[model samples]
Target chain A: MLFEQVNNKVVRAHVTAQSPVLARRGAMLGYSGAVAFRPVRGQGGGVGGFVGAAMSGESNPMMASEGDGAVLYGYKGLYVTVIDLDGSYPLTCEADRLLAHDANLQTSVQFVGSGGVRAAVRGAMTGQGLFTTLVHGRGPVALLSHGGAFPLQVTGQWPVGVDPQAYVGHTGNLSLDLKAKVGFRDLTGRGSGEAFTLQVTGQGTVYVQASEQKF
Target chain B: MAGPSVFTAQSLPDGDNVNPYVYSIGLAGEWFISKGAMLAYYGNIRFEAVSRYASVRDFVAAQFASPVYVQDWVVAEGQGKLVIGDRGFDLNAYDLDDGNLTIKASNLLAFDTRLALKQSIVPGFVVLIGTGRFIASSNGPVIFVEPPFRADPEALLGWADCPSPAVHHDAAWMAASFAGALQGALGRTSGEEKQYDFTGTGTVLMQSSEIARADPAVLRLIEDQTRLLTDAQAGSLGQQLMARVQQR
Candidate 1:
């Protein structure tokens, strides 16, 4: 699966699945030559394991099952430019430096840049919205999403909580902190549903979904 | 503190080019076991003057007769013409003075003036002996001697915190052996740069330059001191007596 921004406001995502499968805006999945239904694991399980799996032919339950490739949704239809198989691709970008991945695909990406342009793009991807077309010439932006690609955008001040592992990308200037549940009496998994949360604060938009709860 | 310093002796390894493994004794100051002597002490040592006698030969001879705390004594003559033992000082022909009666060494342990002219009828012979408490120096070899003779062991040993020469010798030997073992364990060939990687809990990393930079003199001092202390305890003063003979 691949995603790109065109025309400055629209997000265009291209996914190739082995068969027609149901995918939601916040759905969590995996991709390797093809996209399929799979559960994302943490650092010990996700992309790291995929790299190891692809090289050794070892089975990785976190990666989307075999046969799922090339799936499309909405109205954007973009042709594939490069299919990297040798594993020599340099996935370098400004934001990649601050991003960390886990075996279960649970990780955190910090956005840092001079302006809001980068943040806007990351906000669009994490926000729950449909990307009709690609945005052009916004700025260099870094985004991290979990499982499969989804189109989204933030409209206002509503900040979103994202699963650290499922985060594909984000804008370049959001301050981040780890959020833990409050109050000791509620420590039994009752008051605080999640043990840890990634708190992002900024005026810019953030996109996240209920489906990314696993990360 | 006011008297002539007492002297204890230790042996050293004979260096290369010398046969019979000649022994060298270290006295005081830069007086080292000859570089030719093997099994040398590699640490510092200090000698104390327990008693000063005007007639050193007589004092030594008297000590030999009774031996005080001396452990062993033997008298021999002929080709060797030497009396060597912990409790006795046997003299050779050259060791006698012009009078052929008095024993004269540059450094003498004298007790009285008239004692020098006195001679024993033992023929071309000499014998000296005594014992004192073994005291430890703050940073040098430990000496064994008759205890009641000295007031303070530290003052007698001449240092406040010096380790005994025996300790220094052991440390040196252990260090040398350790370095050798490390070199071997690393598969280092002779003349090659050696590096040791101690990677576990207490790790140590060393290079050839470091080993080369160590002082050979210091190593020798420790080894010599250790050997002296051990030999003294064992009552084998071979190296100790040889050292005195060479000094004379």
Candidate 2:
């Protein structure tokens, strides 16, 4: 996929895909022209070997030694970008597993900062991976997801509280408390059943939820 | 019962005066005698004042000054005059709201129970006195008194709801109005000048030229008004208003 900013709007140029890809709503990703395309070895193996091979000369098939096009590849296919400014960019998943599973990717994003300049924080979730990017912050934060994403809000009123196990990522600092759901007579099941619930208090927002099934 | 035998006798200390002593009393009633004179009676039995005559009024007054003794009296509905000792006071069921009774005492034999008086009731010290052990049914072993023994009016008021202004832009209004008035009079004739006076109508007036030139006075009034308005807006309703503003 490839994209460019035109008239304060993001315009898609071209999307090259061997298979059908779902178009996300907010932003499009694609490559530029003048970039070479090639097959890289050792990408389908264990994590260590794949990392080693990617940095070696053997993976230099898709190279942009002289031009502006940045080369990006998936595990199974190669995407070549040509100077087709009118073509639409294809939406592709950076995760190999998601590309294979063809999972639906949904995202909730926000932009913060001042002036014409802004910082973008986009959180995306597939069935197998949770991808979040601080596209313009000091550093990017990426979290692995066991499930898809659900958006949540916590404020002074209607504070969004959740069980600890269900917590994913929170935007600001929050408070915690222990809440009980049982009585003393039921001591055997006390703190054993759905016993204690973690309460989050304070002014901020939190996102919580899990996948529909085991990842 | 043989024709009630009336025995004219002086009060005795620590002695049980019953039946053969010619006391005619029914169920659930108390008759206390002290200093050998009739003191109090709830039934046919006359209570003689043994040592000194201490009326309920005297006991209440003394208790208010310094906590003394509290007692509970439990009288069964159908039983004859049975003097039960130290079994704790039985609270009156019809008088309780939450159904719990508590009593305070200086000694095991003496205790005091305070009652909350109605606002309509006379605003003065009033109390209910009990002797020995006060007992009740399932309701309470507690007593109710007026002019509660230990309470600070100021502290109690601090916890109570207080009045506050309702406007959100009140602080801004005060600041703007005072500044406007002060600046309007900065170079005016001294005799025509005065301090900036803020009317309840949200208007500002210069009382004296001397005060108008007083930068400290103008700043002080602005500061005071701003603080008052901020405090008012932080109250419960103000919080609700702020929430509404955010939602919008």
Candidate 3:
């Protein structure tokens, strides 16, 4: 496939007449050859298309490209990360983190909110929505972060705690629960902003980037 | 992409940057970290309040020497790998060997206990004395410049082995722009008119950009310092502060 990572922070997609690519809206920097950038009508019109947007509030604001030409996609200078998939495990990602994915992959909104538990709002404090997008049957999925993300392996014996803002995504069967350590200082408005945390457990790899997305 | 480097507790580097924005600490005992900077961790690490932790009371007394930072800091103790991030800024680790460095408090992320921290004479800055390792974040990659250079206050990361700085206002520009008015309500001046003039032999660290760190604790720091004022002055200052708050 000619559509590959040009560098650690940019992606170069080579589009052919038969092979089209989907990208985030306004992510095109520059392109050459005969290319057409059009809105993917109703997000390709399928079960995981419009339904995913309405359910998860995941707005692709997406655009599709066709024709025999190469296109470049980049975010707002964020470090671009390309993750190659083999259809072995499904990858879950934040809706805004999606850059470009293969045409074969299916995107859907997956509910991860707490079932009436107030604390388990699933990244509510960090400005992440309750429903995150899931990508499967993929070829390559590109992610974005302020810098690149660091992947940490989680085991059943030990659990991992992550700051809500820095969390990017994860793969495999993982459960996240909120752990707030409210100190006496919170009453005086001097509380450590670190009080809210996401405790992750299960068998999977959790991804975290360096910069917290401030709402 | 075949894969990026996968890090585990054992594989994460000790006291190093995992990426431009993330720092990894191979912690065994304890480290002083600014609240909320921690991103994630592996192993049995517990973060305890600096003001409320009874077990750390003596350690706090013996090690922590700055009261201004008490409310914003915590002691993380345990065996494991800890990762910390600061709002997407570039993270840099500096090793102080029997030397001292002063940094903007908001940029400080974590420091080893071996270093004694003291409030700097300059407001919003802290001085670290002794030998230890510390992490600081900047809006961009830090640029090292020698003395005889004036820097924008917002771009300055810190300075090592340098004496206190003096404010350098461009009198020429002030005269040109504001008719030489130093304290005029109507004087309109560019933010660049003021700079920190540095001299002597030392290294000055600056970020590439002028983006400032969020300083929520500055209010508290100013509140603490206002205690040194007389009652009459305090009352007048209180009214001014109230007016300023309302204006905001």
Candidate 4:
């Protein structure tokens, strides 16, 4: 793995000439050795990723860092988690959640509502926009979240329900559907604060943070 | 390197903390959860607003006695592992075995249905009584201190098994400077001059940081208490409040 967790809230990525690092702009806490950071526009998914970011309102301005040293990365005091990708399952996440990742990984835009209009509505309710960033052929992807984030294993038999505000990312084959638990009583009274929940079906892992605070 | 723990539907702990900022409540029957506190849940569970649930469930009205907090709490029922968190604050669950704990309303996250919640006489606080578990959040790690001490109002998280703290003023500081005296006379002292004085035997819970969230119920509680004041006094109080706002 190129990214090693220095602490719960920080990650140290060993940067090399061959394996450069794409990191969030202004997230470099510090670095050692000779590392050069250049602001790169639309660095994640190329042309398609740029257009998707504009359309999806999920813009993540990244910087390219390359040198022969270790670079420390952190953002907004958020906790960091590194997911190792074996080129099997693509990691789906919001662009802003991406802290740092191997520049060798392939990036593309994926529709949050891969199932059409109904899924689009779910995506809107999640406040994550219509398109999400998909990292393919990743060596290691670093993500940030409030408090910290943990993965919940999802199986074919048991589905997991998550609050959209707490969702960080997911890996493997999974279908996300929005379930509204609202009823007549909810319409009448103050209503349940948690009226909508994101249901993850199929098989994979869902990453969620301890907080429901919208970023 | 090892990352955060991975939890499954069956592996989530029962009424235990997943981390310092997250708590997992294994639910079979019911729990009184603060509104917007839940992060996620596994299995079958339903969250009903206390206002709506009070009409259907007889016990809701009996357990939740603070009307001001009705809008901020919900009842989660059924079988599931409910996860809750508060704005990245340090969270801890305390067990109250037939005891009472008065806590800052905004800091008290969730409580058991077996415990009864009552509005504390202290404006912005609530008391939980009976044998059950409840979760609370603090800006930092909670520090346990004893009685015969004075605490800054913002730093005081809560006091358990003790009479409500009395307002304490630093008389020496008040008399130290003319400007300070003037501010105190105008009821606009630097906020460091006033404190909560605790006496008797009890544990006082304090957060390492003084930052705290404003309780939404405080306005209503203060509004409700206004009925005791005469109209002239109320008018003067309004003027004072407006002056304070203007100064800010």
Ranking by lDDT: 4, 3, 2, 1
Candidates ranked by TM-score, best first? 4, 3, 2, 1
DockQ of each: 0.01, 0.00, 0.02, 0.01
- Label model 4 with its docking quality class: incorrect
Q: Each model's interface RMSD (Å)? A: 37.5, 37.2, 15.6, 16.7
Across A1-215, the per-residue lDDT of candidate 2 in tens digits comes to: 33221211112222234212222111111223432221112122466644543443122111111223421111111111111111122221222212111111122122121112111111111111222211121211222223333446656776765654554545444543445566774586545544545466666555454632222
Q: Which stretches of candidate 2 lie over 4 Å from their true place?
A: A1-143, A178-192, A211-215, B1-248
TM-score of chain B of each: 0.16, 0.16, 0.89, 0.91
Q: If both were scored by lDDT, which would come out higher, candidate 1 or candidate 2?
A: 2
- Cα lDDT of model 3 by residue, A109-182, tens digit: 76666455553365576456676777887587788887678888889997799998888888878877778788
Task: Give per-residue CA lDDT, model 4, range A1-215, as digits (tens).
Answer: 58988667667789999999998865665455666665555433466756666676666666677878876666655778899998989998888889899999977777666778878878777667787888999599999887689999999999999998898999999989888889887898887788889999999999999998754
Judged by DockQ cut-offs, the docking class of candidate 1 is: incorrect
Q: What lDDT tens digits, residue by residue, belong to model 2 across residues B31-59?
A: 22111212223324433221122353354
lDDT of 2 at A185: 48
User: How much is B215 displaced in model 4, in angstroms?
Assistant: 1.3
Model 2: what TM-score? 0.19
Evaluate all candidate structures by whole-model CA lDDT and list the values in order: 0.26, 0.26, 0.75, 0.81
Model 2: per-residue Cα lDDT at residue A132: 20
Models 1 onward score TM values of 0.18, 0.19, 0.52, 0.52
